[model samples]
Target chain A: MSHTLVEINNLSRFYGTLQAVKDVSFTIRQGEVLGFLGPNGAGKTTTMQIISGNLAPSGGSVTIANHDLLEDPRAAKNQIGYLPESPPLYRELTVNEYLDYCAALNNVPRAKRLSARENTKERCGLHDAGKRLIGNLSKGFQQRVGIAQAIIHLPPVVILDEPTVGLDPIQIREIRALIRELGRDHGVILSTHILPEVQTTCDRVQIINKGELVLNESIEGLEHHMKSASLTVAFHQSPDLQFLENLPGVKSVHPEKDGRLRVFHETEQNPTDAILRMAVNKNWGLYEIRPGRLSLEQIFVELTSDAALENAEALATTTTTDSGL
Target chain B: MILTIGIREFKSLFLSPLAWSILAVVQVILGFLFLARLEVFQLYQPQLMAMDGAPGLTEIVLPDLLGNAAVILLLVVPLMTMRLVSEERRNRTLALLFSAPLSMTEIVLGKYLGIILFLLVLLLMIALMPLSLLAGASLDLGLMASGFFGLALLLAGFAAVGLFMSTLTQYTTVAAISTFGALLLFWILDWSGQGTAGGNWLAYLSLFNHYKPFLEGIFNSADAAYHVLLIITFLVLSIRRLDADRLGG
Candidate 1:
């Protein structure tokens, strides 16, 4: 069994009267990259802050490597690293000087501080920018410096908040690859609203809506959710709707706007073979038949839209109760 | 870890134009004050020598200059210390320290010490202007030493108060303004007491009241204790403010 590196149980946070995070719970293990997904103000950053021991939750506890964040924060924090939404770059210092300070701040021993700084700089691809002041460097290099500081102490868990917020496409891809590389050894939790980032780099994804965990599943499970055993097929001629509906194992059939038929089969059946046989025997031209999979954007829209509907209903009921009261 | 933070803070101070500008303005004003006090002392030297038990050059020049230095520091120390934690919060870099394995005490002490070191450097330069008079006259070194010691204590206390104010707000201007206001209040606390009956406690709490003994070449233990207590109080308040931030978030 994989070792649990960070465990959060029923965590909640409130900014005065506003409930920012409510009863959120999740566990992250060694070698697992957990993608924390949420809309704006969905408590992703707050949860990450709690896990990093930067913020105290109103109600629940966080344990890092069996040490409680509140009871033994030093030991717990020593095992976790966090990069907040902003990179936190000290503009006046050179990259080398900033990283060295971070190394010492994270309790890297005097004997090992130099080597650790060098190694982290190399890992974050900050080799050439070491001599340049952070203020003089571009945003991309500043971000790399941010990552270098987070991992200089070699913690077991690293939490990054929006590590790729304002980067070019190539820079975003590089940072994503770097995150994936870090996940190979450390339990990495990154908060991002970018859906494709999760599809590419995350092993598991947790989507939170209104401070509640709405979806938590592996990437494979996400793929399966999108791949509903449906097929989009097109023919040279439009076939009878009744004949298509009467096909074996055909659960539903609908004609799409682009002159193709969307056929959803029963859970246990693949109707491609039966449809292919009938098309050959009847001499009906069949051009294409491909497995259907929803884009991550579509799935995200669907999930959040459902959540929005529930939220609207909840608001309506609360308003009605308020009026009755 | 505290040394690391202190070094970073001290180094950043030199890199900013604000620190340089503060240093230049302060040294120029204090230098001008030093010259004015020296010319006045020289003009009265013969008369002062004929008087019974007249004060020497150190007694006449050093105390007045250091007193002016202290008053000037009342306005300038806030500028030096206003960015200690406020700028870190503004830039969101305080999270780096919070998320690290550091206690709030380390952060507060490190930053406080960093600014104190810079203020000490300023104090050293101002000390040189007074010591430059050694080439022309015989100076009482003991009296000068006491005056310098008092200025050190005053600057440390001022730094602590400024640091606490910085922790209260993310806007550096607010921190600087409120710190100036706080120091100004303490400076005149004794003056306000002079008008009221049975307000000795207010005078006792006055920062200048504690500092005045040192300026007069008298090392009173009670005066020293007051400055120590003031520094400790502000530093403790700063540490608690940072703790509340972690908890409140």
Candidate 2:
């Protein structure tokens, strides 16, 4: 297994009475890309800032490469590179000059600073724009410069907050490719609200809603969750709802318009084979039987929407009533 | 780390047209004043030669020229120092430094030293006007050096105040104006206490009062200490402000 590069334990931050992050904890291992997914104002940026040592956590701790962020900030910060929401560029400086400054600031040795800068620029596709002033470059090129600065020191962990925002589609694709490339060697934490960006780029995904981790799963596990757990079938002649619900391996049955029935089942007990056999034996002319899958977008909405919270509360009250009986 | 940041800061100043324009304007204005003082010295050279206690070219030209330079710098230093921290905050680039493996003290001191380096170059240019008198007549190097030293100390104090003010706001204009206001208040502080009973402390508190002695070739430790103290105090405050930002209020 790859070694853990960043360990954030119970990290919390409060802005006066408003708690921005509440006991958030996660770890990133080397060569893993962790997608930090959240809705707007979900405290993603605040958490990124705390992890990068730009802001102190109101409670809890963060360790970067075994160095406690609060106790040994210099050592911890040295092990990570952060690109904030807005790329921090000095508009007047040339790309080469800015990269050189970043290298120096990151303590790349004097002899190796030039190589570090050149290699970063080349990797970020800024080779030809070395002489151009950053202010004059296109937004895409400027963003590359921002990324170049972050990885110039070759830190073990790289944190990028909204790196592809405000870019054209082509630029976005290029940056995503670069981020995936970085993930090969570095433990990368990418925070974004874009769902596909997470699906296409990350090995693991974490969803934060209302300053709390709503879901944490590996990509394969998320795919498994998205797999069809329910089946939708239609009949020329409608079958009894009670019989459909009582079928082996079936969990519940709900009737829909056009004489269709939706049957849900357990994860391991798929009811498709049983339902097909029963429809033929019972003479219920089944025309359409399709498996239902949940898209990531729906999952994200279900996890983050206010309706989800209310649904959870309603479920809790019913469970209490059942237990009381 | 401080040198790396300082060098970058100094180089960045030249990348903007503001620094070049300020340099050009200051040189033109101070150069013209230097010539005017030399002309005045020539006009009174014969009358002074006959006097018992005659002040020579160094005594007459250096103090007036350097004093005018100080006043001009009083206005210009704020402009130079205004963007030191405030622009970084406004542009959201301070995060670059904050996330780097550097302490607030290193960042603050590096910026301070960067502006001081630029001011030292301006001071060298101003000193050349007095040193040119060495072509024909004997010059009092001690008095010239002391006058320039006083001006350097005064500019250092002004820069510290400007940096502190810059840390107080994200707006560059606000930083510049507040620095001007604070420096102006310190400049004329002694005036309010003049001729009043128990006003000696106020006079001592005034930046100009301490600077006045150095212009007269009086190397008083108290004046030097005063300027150093002012520099340290404001720098410490600036550092504290940055720490507050990191910890969040």
Candidate 3:
């Protein structure tokens, strides 16, 4: 097993009275791409900032490569390369100049700074635009320069907040591929609200809502959750929904407005074949049938909304108890 | 790391038209003022030849030229230092420095040094106007050195104030205006205190009061100390302000 590159324990942050990040914790081992999934204002950026030492956490600690962030910031920060949500670019600087400056800032040895810049530029597909000023480059190229600066020093852990945001489909795909390639050797933390991005680029996914982590699962486990346990069938002729509900492996049946039946079944016992056999024998004139699976978007919405509801209930109870007191 | 940031900041300034325009405008204004002083000195030369222990061309022209340079720099330094930290904050590029393996002290000092280096170039150009008298007229090199020394200290002091002000806001124009307001107050502080019982300390506190002795060719350690102290205090405040940002932000 690879060694852990980052360990965050019970981290919390506050903006005045508003707590931006709650008691959240996670770790990233080398060669792991951990997706930090959250809706807007769910504290993903705040957590990333605290880890990168851009912001101080109100509680708990972060350790990077065995160095405590608060106690040994230089050593701890040396292990991280962070690309903030906006890329933190200097538009007046050319790509090579900016990357060289970043390498120097990261304390890359003077003798090796050039090769580091060259290698990082090559890796980020910035070879052709080395001499171009960042202000003059396209948004995609500017983002590439941002990523190039982050990784120029070859830090052990890279934290990217919304790296693919505001990019075209092809640019997003290229960035995702680059991130996956980075994951092979470095522990990467990719923060975004884009659900499928996590599915494609991350080995593990974490969903945070209302400053709290609601779900932490591996990609394999998420894929299992994504498997369809329900099927939808539209019929040209109406059938008794009760008969379909009584079929083997069928848990329940609900009729749609368009005269379709949605069949919910147990995970291990798919009722598709049974329903098909019944439909054919009864001559129900089934016109369309499709496997129904809960999308990642739906899962994200459900998790976030559920967390919000729970927080509201908890807040209400606290207020009521205060009144009772 | 400080040098790395310092060099990048310095280079980036030249990459923008603002620095170039500031340099050119200051040079033209100072040059015009220098020639005007030379013309006035030429007009007074014959009359002064008959007087005993009369002030020479250096005494007649250099101090006034240097004094005007100080005032000109008072206006120009803010324009230069306004964007030092504020622009980084505005563009969100400060995050790059914040996340780097650097202390706030290093970041502040790096930027401080970059602008100071640029100001040094401006100072050199200003000094050349006085030195040009060396071709024909004998000059008081000592007085000229002290005058330039004092101007350099004043510029450093102005830059420190400007940099600290830059840290307080993300808008460069606001930073520039606030810095100008602060420096202007320092420039005329002694004016309000003149002839009053409380004016002695206020006069002593005035940046102009300390700088005046240098233009007069007197190098008092106390005057030097004031500028040094101002530079150090404002720089420390800047560092603290950035540290506070990391904590409170």
Judged by TM-score, which candidate is best? 2
DockQ value of candidate 1? 0.78
Cα lDDT for residue B128, candidate 1: 93
Model 2 spans with C-alpha error above 4 angstroms: A256-260, A306-325
Give the alpha carbon lDDT tens digit for every residue of A195-239 in model 1.
Answer: 999999999999888899989999999988888768998888788
* Model 2, span B141-219: residue lDDT tens: 9998898899999999999999999999999999999999999889988988888987777776998888888999999
Q: What is the lDDT of residue A251 in candidate 1?
A: 85
- For residues A106-150, could you state the per-residue lDDT of candidate 2 as single tens digits? 999999988998899889999999999999999899889999989
Chain A TM-score, cand. 3: 0.89
Root-mean-square deviation of candidate 1: 3.5
Candidate 3 per-residue lDDT, tens place, B1-249, comes to 777777788888898898899989999998999999899988988889988999988888988988888888889999999999999899998899999999999999999989988999899988888888899989999999999999999999999999999999999999999999999999998997877886777777899989989988999999999999999999999999999988997
The ten-residue window of minimal lDDT in model 2 chain A covers: A254-263
- lDDT of the candidates, in the order given: 0.90, 0.92, 0.91
